[model samples]
Target: MNIDLEDELAAGMREHTADLKPSADLLDRAARRNRRRTAAMASGTGVFALAAVVAVAMTALGGTPAAPPVEPGAPPAPELLTVAMVQERAVAALAADDVQHIVSTVDYRGKTEHGEWWFDQVTGDSRITRLQAPGGAVTMDLWQLVRDDKLTMTQVFHDDRSYLVLERPLDGQRPPGPAGSTPDELRAALQRGEGYTLVGPEDLAGRAVLHLRFDFADGSDELWVDAETYRAVRRETVKHTPDGDARNRLEFEWQPRDDGSLKPLAVKVPDGYTQRQVPPVDGPM
Candidate 1:
């Protein structure tokens, strides 16, 4: 939007303002919403470098004389969004009003796994599925459902054609993952984006998003968040595990819960699959 706006603005403007930059008000508007660190953006690295952009845009557009230069080492004004604020918004994505859907990809040790998870934050009900190496093969499946105030978990291993069902009390058990997905667990993976820097605003799937990058002790990651909703949209990370460097990509969407949406989330057992008394050595998710 800024780029297109700048182009259109430059076309109709006079030559004196040809060097005009983005509006300071626009940057401030974004900052108010994003809550980025004021100190960091002062370096004029990203779009928040409003000291130069605003001065140039305002002076040229207003036809005013340029201001005198500072003596030296003047502090730069700050504005723009940051990772912490976005994560805060995304962490609240588990609003009881609707269901949260997450699509995740994990690439590790020469194999790739794709997963989809759906969970009711308020009700603590969820359905999680995984496909290993594609080709329509489901490696793992799990579902937690609440019926008549009783909660139950069913775990399935398609390769072994076996499943385990256990009745669980709905007290304080948190959602488990790589099979289970929750907003808090998902946010924890990003470590609250401790030192992320802005890569600028970008468009993903026709939706406006903010891109941020960070490096941790063992790896680095890129996170994308919805500009309007402030929910997590996508993530890409490369981490050095004991085995090797693992790469993963996660995508998210918020869906309105309805009967139609429940069809796919329902637990289904194949006609010939056997029910097991115990889970695999890896344990139940």
Candidate 2:
């Protein structure tokens, strides 16, 4: 029985075993499944690589970067010279101009005066005419002339025939120190910025101008300088006095002749007018 047991088991296993083969359709289905799995893995890898590249690009380009923080009560950055350095340039330009023609209007104490002035830088010659309205009516007309450093004043009455002319000496007398009258003086005053400040930019006579202010011991002056030419276009002065507040305004119009020279001005006494010669004053005219 022991000897027959091994052979009987072998024969029994052999009898139960049967030969089987895979079909063409089953093999085709298995190949298709393997290809789909490979394709899916490749697509996932490509998406990961694309995401990494996008992240790098954003970092290099500084996308959505944060701004620097500012400290409390910190002073602002310095402005460019175009805005702050204009005053100095204006002063220099005005000082360099040799000849000037000015038309001005003055309003003081409820009275208005219109004036015309011509100045010669080389010969120190000037002519000035003023038309004044005392009380809303044209009441007075004054003319002043300067030639070869000599000054004369003429006053005309209601009747043009009655006019008084007074001749005065022009020696050692300082010229009027209005904002635009003396370029050298104004330049010096502005250089000392202790009391000078730039108000801002404004429109004057249809042109861009810089508004500057100067505070002095006696009064304060407001000047409007052309932005492009650096010329003083307008000026206003307010003086403090015991009597009251004295205010003055000066407007300048620079007229250069076609020859690029100063226009000539002539001042001659009217016909049949009596001329009076008076002693010269010791002061400046």
Prediction-by-prediction clash tally: 0, 1
The whole-model C-alpha lDDT of candidate 2 against the native structure comes to 0.52
**Candidate 1 residue lDDT tens string, 47-147:** 33333233334344654323333324434443324445555665675444567777788889988778887877656678888876434667898998877
Candidate closest to the true structure, highest lDDT: 1
Worst 10 residues of 1 by lDDT: 30-39
Please give, for residues 1-285, the per-residue lDDT of candidate 2 as tens digits: 122322332333343344222222331232233333434553333222222222222233334212223335322222223324666688678655456656566655655567656665544555555545322333334555565566666665534545667766778553342235556655765676574566555566666666788878888888887766778787777888776667777776665433444433554445786544456777754
Estimate candidate 1's alpha-carbon lDDT, on a 0 to 1 scale.
0.62
lDDT of each: 0.62, 0.52
Once superposed on the true structure, which residue ranges of model 2 sit more than 4 Å away at CA? 1-79, 82-84, 133-159, 162-180, 193-195, 216-219, 257-264, 276-285
